[model samples]
Target: MGCVLSGLKWPRTPSKDHVTPEPLLPTLGLTPQQQQLLIETWELLKQDIAKVGVIVFIRLFETHPECKDVFFLFHDVDDLKLSKELRAHGLRVLSVVEKSVARIENVTRLEKFLFELGRSHYRYKAPPRYYQYVGIEFLSAIRPILKEKWTPEVEEVWKVLFTYICAVMKAGYQEEENKHNEKTPTMKRLEKSQATAM
Candidate 1:
C-alpha cells in the first residue's frame, strides 16, 4: 500500500524546486474512515505527546544529522533527551500536529495554516525536503504508544496526511522565497537590463 501511494509524487511548479501553485491547493485525499482513524489514534498519542516529541527529534537527528544543524540551540548540546531546548522545541512541533489534526475536516483552513508555517520555515532556513522527515519520525514515535492500535490502514492514513501537509508547506516556502528574490537588488538590475535590451 505504501508503494502504491509512493507513486503519488509531490506536485511542483515550473518556476522553482518543489514550489507548488498557491491558488490550487492539494486535496487531503483521506477518506472518512481514515480521518476517524487519525482522530482516534491521535487521542492515544496525545497522552504521551511530550515524550513522543522528544523521541521524534532525537530519532530525526540520529537518522539525519544535518537536521540537527537546523536547530542552532541544539548545536552544542551533547544529549538531546536532557536538553530543555529540545524538549520545548519538540512540544512546539507536536502542537502543530495537534492543530493540523483539529483542522482535518477543513481543508482550506488547514492549507492556509500549513502554508504560513512553511513560509516561517523558509525564514528559519529549513528546506521543504526535511518536512517529510518529520512525518517519518512522527510515525516512528507514535508506534510504541499506539502499539496494537497501529495497523497498516492507520499507517497509510497518517502517511497521506503528512504528504498533504508537506506539499502545502513546500508551496508556501517557495512563494516566500520568490518574494525575497524579487526584492533583491540583483533581481531588479537584471530585470531593468533585460527590459533595456528588449
Candidate 2:
C-alpha cells in the first residue's frame, strides 16, 4: 500500500555546491523564444479577450460548480452565459491577464500587480485553490481561438506565465489571510480544525 520509492535515495544531480539557488521570488522562467511566442499569440487573443473571458468562466463553472459560489454576483443567477454580470466579471479577469502580459518585461511590476490581485481575491472570499482553475479555464478558452497558431511551445509559455501568476497570488492570499487571522486567532484555530476534519 505504500509507495515503493519511499525508501529510495536518488543522488542529487548537481551536488550542494554546484546547484544554483532559486530566486527568492517566483519567476516566469520563460526563454526569449517563449516570450516571443506569448506576445505573438496575445496579439491575436487580445482582439477576442472579452469573448474568451466569458468562455473561461462558463467552462469553469460547468467543470467546478463550487467556483460559482465564490462570485456572489452570479451565484444565484440562472443562465451564466446570458448573465451580463458574468460577462463583465470575465472581462475584468482577462484585463488582468492583459496587464500581466503588458508588463512581462518588468518582473517586479508584474509580480506586484498579480500579488495585489491575489490579495483582492481574498477579500472577495475566493479561495487560493480556485486560482489554478482560472488558469485551466483560460487555456481551454484560448486554445480554440488560437487555432492553428496554438502549438506545444505556445502552451508551454502560457503555462509558465500562469504558474508564476498563481504562485504569487497564492502568496499574497496567504499573507492577507495571516494578517486577518492575527486579529482573529480563535477563528483561525476553528478554521484549522474544520479543514483537518474535512
Q: Top model by TM-score, which number?
A: 1
lDDT of 1 by residue, 1-198 (tens): 556655877443454555444456688977778888889999989989889999999999999998877887887789889988899999999999999999998878898999999999999999999999999999998888898998999889999999998999998998889888868798888889999999
Can you give the lDDT of residue 27 in candidate 1? 88
Model 2 deviation from the true structure expressed as Cα RMSD, one decimal place = 7.6
Which segments of model 2 are wrong by more than 4 Å?
Answer: 1-24, 184-198
Clashing residue pairs for model 2: none
Model 1 regions more than 4 Å off? 1-24, 186-198
Cα distance off (Å), candidate 2, residue 155: 0.7
User: Candidate 2 on 57-94: residue-level lDDT in tens?
Assistant: 99998999988778778788879889889889999998
Task: Estimate the TM-score of every prediction.
Answer: 0.82, 0.80
lDDT, candidates in the order shown: 0.88, 0.86
Task: Show how many residue pairs clash in every candidate, following the order shown.
Answer: 0, 0
Task: Estimate the lDDT of model 2.
Answer: 0.86
Best by lDDT: 1
